[model samples]
Structures are given as structure tokens and as C-alpha cells.
Target: MPPRPSTKKPNSNPLKKKGPENKFQRQQQPQQHSKEEETPFDNPTNTIPLSLQQLLLNVFQSALVPNTSTSQDGKQDASQRDAIEDEGQLDVKPLIQTIKSHLYNRDFDSAFTDANEELLRAYALRWSASRTLGYAGVFKAVLGILSGDKERRGAGGQIVCIGGGAGAEIVALAGVWRDIVALPTDDMNGEEGEGEGEGRMELKVTAVDIADWSGVIRRLDGAIRSSKVSGSKRHPAPLLPDGKRDKFSVTFQKADVLSLPEGELKSLYGQGTVMVTLMFTLNELFSTSMAKATAFLLRTTDVVEPGTLLLVVDSPGSYSSLSLGKSEEKVERKYPMKFLLDHTLLSVAEGKWEKVLSQDSRWWRRDAARLRYEVGEGAGLEDMRFQVHLYKRL
Candidate 1:
């Protein structure tokens, strides 16, 4: 004490200002932190094989003109087929307008004819593909969160698409499963490569729709099987092992999903992880009748097992107008799609469904410059802004 008194002050530092005035300044200084580590789902890859898109266009054209080619050889009939296909091509603008009018008039039965579906595919396949990317991103984000806990890594499950007969969900789910199986991981010994396929699980997609889209789904499945990993600048080589591509099965059921009996609904998922999806489908059901939609969901709550994941994606700010009563006593009201979905799923029981993720709007776009094929002016190959809600059955 005597030495300190003679030499220097005990609580003073020359490097830092010594006063009550600097007390707040010290707390305001930025703290040093180590850089954060990146996770597998940090950046969800949205690229699809160029071959898939090209094949899709071909399929659409062929479906639109079933008898375009009678020749046996491809080279011998290439020009003939092209001319016939071009002639068979319907004007995208008017076709889509007609379809929209039918939909608006609440005549869904007339809008989904075989020819109309093909035309719709030609006009909207790219948009659907873009939406698939959005869905895959959400799937990865959810799976990534579940992966943090060792016991909850069984997030890989069967994908049941309520009205995904157009085949976007098929492609998206298959690609996600392929990437997940091919992703490398560390083993118990802290080594990489061995964890690849350690959690390998087969994906089964059940597509339930009111239309006969089985033919289209089959063609898409064939295309995906034949799609090779093109090591291009835009789509780099995939992580799949040599001679291995995505292996999955798709089952299409042509029926009104909402009208399916509880036993049939329960039969859709046979154990294992089950992720049900309603992509661009729920709004239509609500537009038809909110009462029916509500009843269907409540029935689902009673039928489905726990640990099920329900994923809903639709246009942002989707609204439906309801008219009740007859003649002069009619009353009409407009309701948002998200509000109705939340009310139905979350309010069914005390804890029937737990909302895992919700996004009001997320933009998904396809860069025209990266496309391998030429796009027509009125093809409607634009971007999509969608809302996504993910729920878990408790």
C-alpha cells in the first residue's frame, strides 16, 4: 500500500480513459467473435437439370399432338413432327384466358380437360418448376432444423401431394432426396464420405388429384430417370455416385382428395416420415366451399398420425368470395386463404398441428438467359410470389 501510494494509482490504466464518462463507451464497443460455421441448408440449390426442362417441353408438345409422328425413325420424321407439333400448338394467351375465366366462374369441372391440361402445362411448367425450387428450399430449411438434434434426423419421409398431379412436386421431392443422399457427412471417427448414404431412404410420392394426370406423371418420371448429370457452367456435377440417379416411385390417384374417406386418407401414409403438401391447391378448394374445406381438414386431423408434417404453399394474398342464402337474402364475404388455412389447421383441436414455419411471401424466379430452349412471347413463363406454411402434427 505504501509502495503504490508513492509510485502510481491502483485502479488507473493509461491505455483506457479513466473516468465515469467512459463507462458507457466501454459497453458500446463491439465485441470480438469467431466466424459462424455454415450449415448444409444455408444455401438451398434451386437449379434443375437442363435436360428435365427440355424434356418437359417435348412432353407437353407430344401430349398436345398425340399423333404428330407416324414414322419409325427419329431422323426421318424430325421435320414432319416439328411441323405437326407447331400446327397443333394452341395460343397460350387465349387458352389461359379461357381457363382463368372458367376458374373465376367457379366451373373447375370444365377447366381441366385433357387438352386444356396440356396447354396449361406448356404455359405454366416453368412457373411450376420455379415453385418447386421454393418448396425444396423450405423442405431443406425444415430438415436442417430437425437435423440439429441427433434423434430427430428422420425428417426424410414419404411426400403426399394433395393436388400435385402436374408433376412439379415429384421433381422437387426427388431432387431433394437425391441431394440429401449424396451429401457428405462426418462419421463417428470425425471422418467425411462415410456418412454419405448412411441415412439413405427411399422417397415415395403419392399424387392425388381430381384429373387424369397419370400419363403426364409417368412421362415426367421417365424423363427424370434418363436425365444425366450435365457438368455445365450453370448446373455443376451432382454428388451422386457413378451409375446412380434418383430412385423413387410415384403413385397417382384420380379422385377428389377432399372427398376421400378417412380410411383411404389414412392408407396414403404407411408408417415412416410423412410430409403432406398442398401446393397451389388449397385456394381452389376454399374458393369452391369453405365448409367442405373445413370438414376435410378436421377429418384429416382425426385420420393422420402424430409426427406428420403438412406443408401448404399458395399464391400470396389469395382470397375467396363466399355467397350464402338465396335470392334477396344472399350475403357474400371475402376471406384470405392463409387466414382460413391457419384457422382450420391450428384451431381443429387443442394441439392437432404445430406451425413449424410460415412465410407471407417469397419470390422464386427463373432466369430466361439460363434457359436452354427458346421461350415464346405469351408462354407465361414468369416468376412466382408465394406464401408457405409448414406444420407438424402433435
Candidate 2:
């Protein structure tokens, strides 16, 4: 709704400024000035150190400056870009772009073939995390669920992160629960006497992915270890929350989400509410192949029951396989808004999901991240952008 105009009459007391004619308004007019625009080359956010930002910016120049190399299939081979060699020093932007081309194409074989696992790990740590996003606002948003609602606080559920590369968000999810579990009684919901004992099931954050990136398992191990105690609803009450001896805490599963195993799905969604996060997965998948992408979404829909929480974060370009120019052999597909959500929730698809929050932002300023991206005219040849859809099964 548009805001209602203010009803107050201007300066009936004659002390307030009403318009340009007012003394106060005239006094302030001279102080107003036009602001200069900033760019990566000149004025930057400087959230990232200037030296590192320059290096990162340089990588962009080195990668996109030319027509670039072609793969065996005659398409742009982002992976084979000149990132290493003569100086024995690495220019990571080129390498990241290459891996991304393969990754965005969903070609894991070429993406990981002879790839320096450690370097890729380093790239995720230093580049993807910083360049893409830094804020854990989403985690806090999720955690707020358990904080505000008394019914939800006692029903700790499983957090399953699909396509959890490097497990960055997975770690953040666990961290939120960790702090939640470590909270004092008053901090948590319920009357003054209510405690952890009030909750029957302990919260679990699981990282599901095809590739187990470096530091993922260890980092998850630490995060999970901090979320458990003895008897309080944990199965068999393991010594730690790592879920090592038994299934008690965080789990890292190496499996393709397109056809997830039924046994694992049942275990996760069998008795309690299950929270699923699809972070940039649909974008990458749909960009490469639409049929496979639909199949994957269907598979996820098949598993979820009513009351399941799903958070989908993707790009419209990927969601629709956006092509800038006309293609000779094929045409790009344009999906309707919330296409994924509608399919997953429609009666024909089995799961009936309810839209909780759906927002599309353009040139949105990502909190704490220096970069900004917009679709259409505002976007560059390459820009990191996002659109979000939050849902819950009916």
C-alpha cells in the first residue's frame, strides 16, 4: 500500500520548515551537494583489503578480456584459462571462472578432473565466501523461528542443506543452533522454569552434497560436537554431537540430490519437521539442463511432507536458462515466477507447499559484501545476483 500523505498543516506554529520559502530550508539548501559515484577501479567499499580487491579485480580483467579458450566441445572452456604456470603463482579468478563454467554446466567430471582440490578449497574460502555474500542474516532469520514460537522451540528439527559446496552455509546453520543450545533457560522460550528438557528432539544440521570439499568434514565435525549433551533426546546419547557412533548430530552425506536415497530421506523427515535449503543449486542446475533440473525438483518434492520448511535461493537467469542473443540450434526457456515453488507444491506434484516469503531484489546491496549485482540493464557481462523464495509444506 502506498503511504498516506501527512495530514499535519505546515508550521502552524511558524517554527518548522515547510518548503523552499522557509528560513530553515533556505539555510540548508547551500549545504546540499551532489555525491560522487564509486566503482571497483576508483572508490570501492574497501570491505576487502585494497590489495586483495585489486588482485581480485585484476583476475576479472585477465579472465574476461579476450574471447578466451574453447573446450573439447568448442564452447568456452572457463577451466582451461591461464591461471597457473610460468611464475608458479596462481591467478585464482581465471581458475574460479573455469571451474564455474564446468560447475554451472553441471559437468562435474571436467569440473573436478585433475583439479587442485586444495586450491579450489582455498578459492571457496577466500573468494566465493567474500565475493558472493558474507552476512549470516539468513541463519538468524531461521533461528528466529525457534526463538519466537513456543511450539517450534520444543520441536527441534533437521536442517538439510542441499548442494552444500564447501559447507559454508551448513557451518553457519550449525553455529546458530549451537548458540541456541548453549543459551540459558530465560533466553529460550517458555516459562521461567522451562529448559532444554522441554524440547524432545535435538536440532540437527546436515550437509548434503556430491563433493566433500576440503575442511568441510572437519569444520562440520567441530560445529556438531558443540551441539550435543548426554541423554536429552539424542539417540543413544553419544559422547559428542558429531553423530560418529550413532546418528545424533551433524551429518555430511556425499550423494546426488537429483535422486536422493529413500532411506536417508525417511530418516530425516520421518518423525519431525525438516528444513531444506537450496542455496544456488537450482540456478546451476537449470542453467545446464532443464529436464534434469525439473527431475531434481520433483525428487525433492516427492520426499517432503506437509510442514516441511524449504528455503530456495536462486537467480532468474539460471531459473530460466537466460540467453542474451538468438540461438541457431536451440531456444532458451522462460519460466514463470515461482515456477519451482508452484511445481513442488501443486497437487499434481504431491507436496502442497505454502508460500511463506517470496521476494525478488535487483541491484540489492548484500549486507557486508562489497559487490552488487542487478539483472537486465543494471547487470554487467558477469555479475553475482540473487532471488529468494521461502516456503513451507501445507
Candidate 3:
């Protein structure tokens, strides 16, 4: 067969790449991978752009097949493995029940998929992964706004997203870092070239969650690195003002938000303009107990200084049914405001850290004509009561 004709016009003066490729470069930066124990996603095949659910589903399907060795020792080892897995499964029994209720009730009204397959694999997958682009824009705008609080304007800071599985927050920070370095300073009114090198900064983000998201995140980071390293005409990574890639590193840690160790919060964040995000997790926590959920919210606020930014996203509905319903009947609350109005927030409001951004998803959709953001594709509007809030300590 003959070679296909080129669709894109060839550039006369293409830029050359002068950075590290995926595995080799990753090896050079030992501190970045020091905390993680998983193998690096070096191969191109591992970098395919698949959703977290699909990747984990493939992992599960692969695990179902028996190993090649079928001797008596192998059988014993398999039994031991099964016993360990069963022990872990005991903790998720309640979650299994919830999945059963959702499926049996035929309540496909949620923004996430209604398929039985999806329901079964929900534990390993990230249900909120589809909001990648939307969150990227939101975080970009936010970092732009916070540029002033910088150690230097538009240059240095850190971002931490709670429950940021599958690298959604990583992608968002990467987009923001690139824009910061390439584009002129947002506050500067001069031409593009005026603020050159002013926005170059180092950013670090920590994704805290119980499930291991290293595989998917490594795949994405590897893909991006490969794209930048090749400087290929086929697919190129966006370059910074200095024609270099930004050092936006993402690290993952296994943690339970509600029960994080005492003082671990302060040790992790330190004293800086750290932006802590509790997206999608608050409402999920409320499924069990609002009191415990409120405790989780309070503990998050305890670590930050007067200027730390707290971003929250969750469903919005009255928890009155949960609090006021029969003693035996279970009612899971959906409102973020309830957490706000709870007595716990009173401590946080010590005449400081006022609420800044408060936008309900329903309100945005209801009045789309006057909205600031274009809802991403297939992001169900009605089912998700996606409310976003930002509080900055004074």
C-alpha cells in the first residue's frame, strides 16, 4: 500500500525537544518516585488513553485466569491469596450492599453509568474521572487568581487534591502549569513577550486516597513525558516560555480522610498557600454518618494557615430525612451546605477564611446562558448536584 498523504501542513521551523523521556527521565528524578513502589509505565502500549474504570476492569479480568503452574504448592499459594483477599473484602461489605441496592432499585438516575458491569467494578474505578477537562479549566482559573499570593507572582506554590484518583487533578495542574509558563502573566496587561520567565514555577500535588492509582497516573505521566521528549510532529507536548517542560510532579499516598493520623496533616502540607480539595468525597462519606463526615471536614481545616484555600465539591440535598427519619431507616444526606451550617464550621469561621466561590451545579445548568463554564460532554446535569465552594483563610 502507498503512504498516506499528509493532512497537516509541515512546519518549516519546528522546535527541538531537550528534556528527559519517560522511564530514563523518571529514573533521573529519584525523589519523585521515591515514595511510590510501582513499576514505571515506560512502554508506549501502557500509555493508551483509557478511562480508569476500563484499565482496572482489564486488570480484574486478567486476574480471573488461573496461573500456568497448577501443582499442589500452587494450589496452596492460591488458597492463601484467596484468604487474604477475603479478609480485605470484609471491610467493603457495606459498600457491596450499597451497590446491590443501587442496582436492584434500578436507580440509574445517577450521573455515572447504570450498567451492571460498571456497578460491579465501581470499587476500583473512579466515577468522577470524566470531569477531567472541566476541572482543568476550573483549576487553571483558580491558580491564575491565586498567582498574587505567590512567593513571587505566578511562580511557586503547591496543590493537594483529596481523593484524586486516576490523575484527574494531576492533568488539571499540568494544564495550569503550562499556561502559567507559556502565556503572559494574567495580571500583566502588556504583550505576550513582556512577562517572559516571570511565570516559571515549580508545582507539586499530592493525591491522597485508599485505592492505588499509581498505574493509571504513571501511564499518563509517561505519555505526556514521551510526547514532550520526542518533540514529534505527529503529537507534541506544549512547551514552556523557555522551550522546556514544567516540573509538575504528582505523588500518590494511601490514606483514609476520616481517620488520618494525628499531626500527619500539618506534616504533609506545612505552612504555605496549599489548596486542599475534598471533591466528591464529602457526600460519599455522608452515606455513613454525617457526624463523622463533619469531623472529617473539620480535621481538613485544622492543618492550614490563615491563607490556605479549601475547595469542596459534593452533592446538594437535604439531610433532614437522614437526621429526622425513623431510628432504623437509613437516609444518606446529599447536601454540602449542611456541613457548612454544622456547628463545626463555626470554629473555622473565627472571623476569617470567608467563603469565596459558591456555585451550585443545578443553578449553573438552569441558567446556562449566564454561565462561565461550558459543561463537558456527557456530564449529566440533573443527577449530579455538583456544588463547588472555596474558602480562603484571612
Candidate 4:
């Protein structure tokens, strides 16, 4: 006989203990995937174009199921002994849930297994695509203003994304650069053609995370480059001032941001128009250890030069717990994310960061109904509501 339904109350902390099993679990049966409807690439919209989203899906699909081949004697090796599986048969919900559980439990190391890396990365990309676009929007807005400032011009500088190894930051920054170059010369403050190479405003992105997300970032880089070559014909690759293909380079560095020394961190920051991003990342650090987080901010300030920009995007809500006084007389308090960031970064004794932009809440949505890949039946992607804070080092 089939198992009966569970009657226990849902656990507030999913990581604490296992929840009751759902006997009537919904399964995502294999179904035909649909393609995204084409849309103009240069529409000046904050969201990712449908065609580009489709490209992401295509790249993910190819990675999920590569062409299989037999050995020399038509025999399979131990690795290939297991039968290959198609995308449809790949149960993504459990993998996603596992990742969520690991993250909730602060077990980041467990989330980086080879078996689940692709799925983990895919889930993150799908879950935060809108947030990524939102980041791009904020960057574009701020850079447009900074472009006019002679001292803060960051035309050919690097963008360092702490905890952005999922490659969202890379995609967003690439989009921003594309939009910038597509503009007329007069709008770019005439700094476009003065970079390392003539007419080449090279963008270097480094995605740093504790997890070994090198494979994921590598795949994403390939996909972005591939899209430029074979994507929508209407939107041919944008050209540099020298009439050459625009250059956007990205690399993945696996490291713990909180543990990096000042000199190493400075080297990573590089020079000229440097920007650092902490999308859905800062809160995690605070949650882990307020002391460590505070040290990280102080260390960052000491490393990065003045005029560097720091952009942080995270879920809009108060989810931080702070402890005050000694252990016996300790008092715990819950603080809002923005307040924590402000209190830490703004209240620093030396090298205080100037608050450039702060928004309590901002909504971002994307229409993923037409996507070629489905996460699972009844597992549609939800829109994001986040808070954004931008700062400039003094």
C-alpha cells in the first residue's frame, strides 16, 4: 500500500531536522521543451533578452547531456558503464533542494560536489537571473553618472564579484559593457578609445567564491562567447571603435573572501575603475560571523584604493542576529540587512565608505514561462524583491 500523508508542522529551520516526506510528491515527467520567442537584444531594457536566455538554456542542455561514444573495441569504460541520461530524466528538484538545505545549514563545502555542481550552478542562475539583471541595471545607472566624472572614470577597469562564482556577475557586467559600447561616442565621455588597446575597453571579471565553481564559470564564459558568434543575426556582435570584435574576459577564482590577506586582496582588486559586488552574499557572511564580516569590510577598505565602487544586492528583509555583552549576560537582537551594512561599512574609524545609493526594496521580474528548460512541474521560478546599496571608498 502507498504511504500515508504526513501531519507534522513544517520546520522553521529546514536544516535542523528532516521534514516529513510527501507521499504524493509531484514528478516532472519528461516533456517536450519549448523555445523562447525572439526579442530585440538592444531594447535598453533592464531584463535579459529572451533570445539570450534561450542561449543560456541551450548551453546548459549541451552541458547536461554531451554526446556519448564507445571505446575502441566498442566497449565502455567504468565511468561510461552507467547508462546515459537525458535532460528530461534528470530530476532537478531534489538536487536543488539538497543545495538549498546545504546553504541553509551553512554547509557550503557540501554544496560543491561534482555530482551536484552543474545542478547547483543551474539552479542559482535560474533563481537569480532577474537579480543579475537588476545588478546590471544598477551598474549601468551608476556608471553612466561616473562616466562624466574625470577622477572616477572606469572604462577599462576590472569588476571583482565576491561570491559571484555562479557567473551571474559576469553575465550582468558583459551586458553593461555591451550597452556602453553600443552608445555613440559623445555619450561615453570620450574615454572609450583610450584604454589598453585602441578602441578596446577590455572588461576583466573575477568571480570569487569559497566553492569550486571553476567549471560552472568556464561553461558560462563559453556560452557568452558562443552567443556573440551565433546568436540573433539582427543583433550582430557590437564592434569596438577600431572596428574589431569587442573584448570581454572573465575568470573564476576559488577563495574565501574573509580569509584573504590585505596584499592578496589588493592584488585581486587591481587598478583603475575597480568595482566589487556582493549579491546575496553579504548577509551570508554576517550570518556566519559578525566579527569576521566586520574584519572583511575593514580589510577591503585598506586594500582597495579611493574611488572604487562597491555594489551589494541581497534579499529585502531583516535576517541578521547579533549578540551583545558577555556570554552570561548576552542579549540577542535582530537587525535589518541595510542597517547592518551601514553600521559596519559607514561607521568604520578609518577609510569610511560613502553611501552613494541605498534602496530599501526594489522588485525585479522576468518572464520565464517560455523557457526551453523546466526546473520541475509546479516549480516555476519566482520574481525577486531585493535591497541594493552602493558605496564609494573614501
Tens digit per residue, CA lDDT, model 4, 1-394: 0011233321111111122212231121212212342111112233344544433433333333222212222232233222223333445567677766775776666765333565655455455444455565566665454444545443566778998876667766665555554332222232334332223355678889887778666655654554222233322322111232245678788788888877778778877637888988898888878888878987887778777788887776647898999999999988887777776776553235666555555555455555444434323445555666777776
Per-residue lDDT over 215-318 for candidate 3, one digit per residue giving the tens place of the 0 to 100 score:
54554454333322212121123322234445566777766666777687666676554688866655555654666667776666666776677776555442
TM-scores of the candidates are 0.69, 0.54, 0.56, 0.70
Which is superior by TM-score, 2 or 3? 3
Point to the candidate with the largest TM-score.
Answer: 4
Worst 10 residues of 1 by lDDT: 1-10
How many backbone clashes can be found in candidate 2? 2
Candidates sorted on TM-score, descending: 4, 1, 3, 2
- Model 2 C-alpha lDDT per residue in residues 127-195, reported as the tens digit of each score: 343322221334445455545456665556777777665554644454334333433232322324344
Q: How accurate locally is residue 177 in candidate 3, as Cα lDDT from 0 to 100?
A: 57
TM-score result, candidate 2: 0.54
Higher-ranked by lDDT: 3 or 4 = 4
| Residue pairs in collision within model 4 | none
Write down the RMSD of all candidates, one decimal each.
15.4, 16.9, 18.0, 14.3
lDDT of 4: 0.55
The parts of candidate 3 lying over 4 Å away from their true place are: 1-129, 150-155, 182-193, 228-235, 238-246, 316-343, 346-349, 362-385
Where does candidate 4 have its weakest 10-residue lDDT segment? 9-18
